[model samples]
Target: MLETINRFLQKWMLLIAPSAVILGVTIFSWLSSYSYLVKWVFAFISFVSCLGLNIRSIRKAVMRPFPIIVCLVLLQLIMPSLAYGIANVFFANDPYIIMGFVLAYIIPTGVVSLMWVSTYNGNRALTLTIVLINTLLSPLLVPYLLHFFIGTQVSMDTYGLMIGLFWMIVAPSILGVLVTRFLKEKINKTASFLSPFSKFALIFVILVNGAVVAPYFRSFDGTVILIAVLVFIIACIGFIMGFFTARIFKWEKGVVLSIMYNTGMRNNGAGAALAVAFFPPSAAFPIVTAILFQQFLASIFGRLANYYFHVMRRRIDRRQNGLTGI
Candidate 1:
């Protein structure tokens, strides 16, 4: 039974980080309405789960940084505009409504994308490279991306936004890097024991975001449907493209899963915060929902990828053993 659990985790590790947050949030939120303690505890847990990404053997990761850049540029700068341009044709009548749709595109990469990517024994170093660069570049790129593309709805207070972003993205990145550098060898020793609860941390974030959006869902009439459709489209596109891109390059399962997280995950935490800080509450709704939906869908996709990878490995092993007479 214990071996079975270990096998399950190894197969689904990358995907489980986010699941931990989503599921944790659901369980905690239900267990406590008056206890503010639970939320803060889980929030820190969520942050730590993501924080693990910055711990790097950086020297090893820098060898091939090109794919990392391409993904960041494509996702941060190009994708939102693509969504806006496409959604415009469909949502021209209600531009603000469409702005909700564009919210998904304007969002940046998930730092936690690196963490889960690590779970699959993915290109942790590569993911760290992309996430760190994307996060640092986000302040300049995110605002400009919104201004040029969906600037009509999402506004940026340059000083306020930059400063706010620094605390959230930069500060976290630095602290995480520090932790990983100093604590890596130590933490790795206990990683096996602590990994299960890591799922709770990731799942907590998603469920909390979902609960946050649940209230907003009541306020808006058609926002949920529009945001859902647009995000779901990008999620599908990101997942499909990521897999093929990995296959085309003949990347290992880890690299493929890392890219999947990079492509499919959105920096909705940053996006939603900007929406609230810079715009009205209405603008934040879609951004919030986008986070939940992307995580949920990506989790499903991650499972499928894990299953296929395991099955494929067995086939190759059988062939090598001459068991199948290949």
Candidate 2:
């Protein structure tokens, strides 16, 4: 029964995400009261997401660390810098909103990226390793990156934010990895059983965080529309950047797919939690809005990547055949 439910959720995830946002906004008042649950729920999701990971995969993935290093540079430096520039140019007057844009992009890559990578036959070990590294380091990287980009304009609890990430992301991730290491094969069955529940927990987090940014939608105007548009465009650029980077480096198809999803997806739940806990509602706005589109975009891009690789394979085969004939 749980497997059936998990399959259903996976199949309809694109619709489920936007529906959760709409439902959360529609009943913001009731959900807003339970804002305290975000951290705990996020921690649970993080834990569940990490259940498939183990130290061995991570160690193996790091043996050739160039791909991981490239992904880190894209996630931490290049993308956030682009976001900061775009936000300043468009929302120059509102520092909070500009910070929102930066926060939306700077968070660690989502564990959900693994789901997409698995579905597309990407390198699971590489994706898991990147997720583990980024998530573990985020406690430090996120706080410092925020301060570096928008410190002069915004006053944030940098220490508090770091601690929050550790509890909500780093600590739980380590526990999950340990659990996987100990349980071995049994954990796969357990993880499958709990997959549906974890996804439900994710939905709950989105619902509550959506409520925190409910007020923004109530007075939705051109500015809100503009922010959403820019956020979507920037998110698209992330996938493109990763795809081209892997291609330029002449990586395999699996590595290219892994990098694309990792680059494109952010752990918006963590981002929203930090935004609400540390900054104003404006800072959470871009993140909450991102939740509405992340899965949908993932679905679209997954298909595109598949088609691209298929065509490339065909062209390569034809060229090889021609060379043999000559």
Instruction: State which candidate has the highest TM-score.
Output: 2
lDDT of 2: 0.90
1-326: candidate 1 lDDT, tens digit per residue? 44456567545644554453345345434532322233343334334444445334555666676677666766775567667876778767655555655666655577657646755567777776766777677767665655676555444466775665666566655665566567777755444444555444434444445444444555555655766677678667777777777777787787788777787787665565555455554565666556656656666777788888999999999888896575
lDDT of 2 at 30: 69
Superposition-based RMSD of candidate 2 using all C-alpha atoms, in angstroms: 1.1
- Which candidate number has the best lDDT? 2
Q: Write the per-residue lDDT of candidate 2 for residues 267-309, one digit (tens) a residue.
A: 9988998888888888999999988889989989899999999
What TM-scores do the predictions have? Answer: 0.71, 0.97
